[model samples]
Target chain A: MVFSRYNSSHSTAPSAPELPPESYHQPQQQQYQSYYGQPSSIYGQSGGFPAGTQPDVVRAFQMVDRDRSGFIDEHELQQALSSGYQRFNLRTIRLLMFLFKNPYDSLRIGPAEFASLWSCLGHWRAIFERFDRDRSGKIDSMELRDALYSLGYAVPPSVFQVLISKYDNGTGKAGLDFDSFVECGMIVKGLTDKFKEKDKEYRGSATLSYDSFLCMVIPFLVSYD
Target chain B: MVFSRYNSSHSTAPSAPELPPESYHQPQQQQYQSYYGQPSSIYGQSGGFPAGTQPDVVRAFQMVDRDRSGFIDEHELQQALSSGYQRFNLRTIRLLMFLFKNPYDSLRIGPAEFASLWSCLGHWRAIFERFDRDRSGKIDSMELRDALYSLGYAVPPSVFQVLISKYDNGTGKAGLDFDSFVECGMIVKGLTDKFKEKDKEYRGSATLSYDSFLCMVIPFLVSYD
Candidate 1:
């Protein structure tokens, strides 16, 4: 019912790719292939969704692109996500935009880009729910630590301080809600991915020159702005 | 045979506390009580060794205090630990001293303090071995992450960089051997424990005024020197 509210009969929108009626029954691996081949290096690793999730992503994009413009900006993304998940604040939405920036247009993500972003968000949402074990709608530092551990990132407690200082919901509380958790997970994952790019041997150390290091890291730092 | 090398027929040393010959047969919990009530708050939380471990700690201390002075300095600690565990470097020994400083003497730890410190190291050693899954005698960044995670610290990948830069054994390679790993663990554990004291609600955060916060934190930063 929540999704139907955003449907404007734009199911016939041609800018969005057409889904074959029989595509759902095809081999599951082939359907997820469409979600890949995007320009998102930060998310490239987590590309490809579980089988049968493609249409739902496309439908979500269609619902948010209520004007049938074939594209949706941060506001539309927020509305689309709120309908499907919960409301995500503007700052987190902006950070998501910075991370999943649409290659064709900086201001909006099209069908393919939206699918990629949604898949990534779904991945993070699962992680967020798993670590929010207290069901408190947020995760404390210990939970955050465990969540990051499961992702193969062992951050120090000091990093917890930095994360809370940056991503806490400004409500004078200590934990992170879903939106902020996603934002935090993305930044850490992004930075680690960036680092791992240089650490190809996976020895956990890299030898990048000063300029090269700055160029690699500066974008993630300033992306939300 | 390795321990016999350090034995100097000083088991009768009078300065160290006398161990009742039959203490070993007592209930397991009672044997561990002597390891607690130390002045080292950082290690107090980890006080008490496993059952029947007290005699081993005392024997290790006696072996190192060859002069029968009832106290061991950094050199003696290095010798003592090397006898039981892998040889710990002087720097790590000094870090241990800083963390488990003797109440009556800054430069040395007597039998009681030594027991507390040993039990804490045993705790960390078990953690270190568990995460060093490859049994490589050292842990790369990923393993370090798991180690810290087990200890309730989820540091950022960036902190791993800091730790590697600081504790990477000066070998031009990344990864920390036992000594450096222990040093890293203690500093992180110490800082986290301090923070948790003020974060009484376990919310992963605490609010402190400028001076109080600095006083709480600066010591951990400068303690090595």
Candidate 2:
């Protein structure tokens, strides 16, 4: 499988800090298991790490905050995530920074935000593994759809086309590497979540006035700005 | 989920020939568990049955082949399937007949074809369950994509639009019930399998001359005629 090809290098990284397989140590596993898991509240409230996962999250932060700074920028966040998990693309790293931006520093994430981000990644990892059924370190269009479906969105084929084009590996191969996969998943997820806030009845459609719609979309548009 | 509304009646049916849960007793369960599971060859040779699953398949055939004419037409096939599984749409039943037409009767399937069809449905059922994560008795566009992914096809979102539109419930519910879901799945699986025959290396692209492409698609176009 393609996963073997990609995971082979990281399997032997000498200094990489390893967290236990998600099933092993996390007591609150079930609480935040889904892609739309409980972390939204946790994220909004700037809560600390879920009880059992703190040590691992803190250790990863300290490793990347090499200068003993209280926060890690995109480069450090990338290093921190890669050492503990798969390497994230710079675009995804920036997206994460934007989502989990520190209150005091717009360019970086602090411990609480970092912890929230890590917890969120754990959920995304679970989702990624579920859809990457071939263990190919990436998901093709079919896998992407399945991932989106599990999250309760019945997107059209056009959605897949746009996502594949956006997240393509650039090798002309139609697959999304881990970083791109998570980014795509989060995009679908984040948007669906936002839409659902308006679709309180779960009717699979929502009505948003112009300003209301812009408020929902502008965050994503300006995130990189 | 919506499944409760759709499945509750069938759950209480008096004559339903309940097959054991897929995990229960079938020895050959693992052999044919995938959407592209081993039944293709089993299907090609007009083989009798996969050894351990014979009884259930035979029983289903006998129950549907009520006249004992060693044959069951579309209506009978639909009845048999709905009893053993969920109700399949007539269009899907027609699609099945087109694919598994009896040697002596173009409008129906015989014992061997019926057995093959049953086995194939078992595999589709497993896939349906996996992607119907919400147990809504239907798969939305997202669920549809996940199902396709498991079968190794990464379709674009536009494919979802086409499929969701094609297989839609007509209730404006942007979802596919079991019958429509199976039809959609089979269409994708059958096409991929056919294409794979030409592209042995699985390069995610295939080259076919004009005649070859026509030969590949003409059957589906002309199947109903």
Candidate 3:
């Protein structure tokens, strides 16, 4: 069956298309430039962030920056992630840096950028809690699958397993903490948006070859390639 | 302000774009013929309907198609809507007919198409119940607004009012029952998907002109135009 093939391929090998790291870095550089040019333009503009949460976001960023350098570098980020929230692998950290609009590949996060990232992360945390119905601090694979579906992505089981494996600890239990949950949500949201682009005729769904699906989801996955 | 203009315009006049009924009827005819030509191809393929719910959908359609005509016309749909579920207006019924792939402009729904529609509605119902938090047999306008946000639509207040007024009972209270809730969900999902298409660059948001918003959501609105 198609799903079984997807499962076998996923289990045996990593799935995302192999791109040079520079290919990943270029667009993010441009995105950061634009974002820095108009930092406040991103959040609260789209009702994604709550009205007064700007202050909260700034405070959160200040607490993470600690050194008063007005920027949170990779080391600071690592400390923040490891101390209180979920622990993320290096690949996930790199993705977060890119997403948080690290300017000119500086690998550091400034206040405006950090505020935007913080607010978005807050939104994702709320979503995570909603789906983490048992208050277990982690969402099991089943909950994660349902969350994706509710967000309008109906991933195959193998694709789902790959998603779970990306975040699950080595303990053999398939679950995702808040950071993993946020990462997964962002990836799914991006991919689902892309799929909807191809489905413009609104024929009710979009069909993609498995290869295309991997291309869309691969960048967010921890790269073993 | 932009919101004030939207609200005043909506209050003073009907908001959906005007098109000849024939214009609305044409593409749906093609869609229905294509759907009927390949009936089962519609449901499970799209990831819209979950696996293993086909039997439940078939049973639901059978129960609704009381005459055993193997098809459900507007009257049968009306019976189904009014008896066990919530009531909907004529315009809403026409929209549902188009969505359900009514065959050859006959305005009658066949088993396969009905099953597909039923399953999608089941998904929407689960969403509705989750937000219907009070279990009061209706979702108030506030709940409806939050539901849309949770579903990733960041609609403005005026747009939300327009949405509420479409389904709210005449008691001056704004709330939606199951059928109305389903109709609203379908419209929002379609619009949000279209918006995401325009937001492909993922600059975090899509900006649609009022005209474009109307063009996308008009067909589903009760057309007093």
The DockQ of predicted model 3 stands at: 0.01
Residue A51 accuracy (lDDT) in model 3: 40
The deviation in Å at residue B44 for candidate 2 is 23
Per-residue lDDT over A33-96 for candidate 1, one digit per residue giving the tens place of the 0 to 100 score: 3435533331233333233456667666667777655567888999888766877866567666
Measured by TM-score, the strongest candidate is: 1
lDDT of each: 0.54, 0.54, 0.50
Chain B alone vs. reference chain B, TM-score for every model: 0.64, 0.64, 0.54
- The residue-level lDDT of candidate 2 at B109 comes to 65
Q: What lDDT does model 3 reach?
A: 0.50
**Model 1 lDDT on a 0 to 1 scale:** 0.54
Candidate 3 TM-score versus the reference: 0.33
**Model 3, range B147-182, lDDT digits (tens) per residue?**
655544445654555456445432335667766665
Candidate 1 ranges beyond 4 A from true positions: A1-51, A66-69, A165-173, A223-225, B1-225
TM-score for each model: 0.37, 0.36, 0.33
lDDT minimum window of 10 residues, candidate 1 chain A: A1-10
Once fitted onto the true fold, the runs of candidate 2 whose alpha carbons sit more than 4 angstroms away are A1-225, B1-50, B66-69, B101-107, B168-173, B222-225
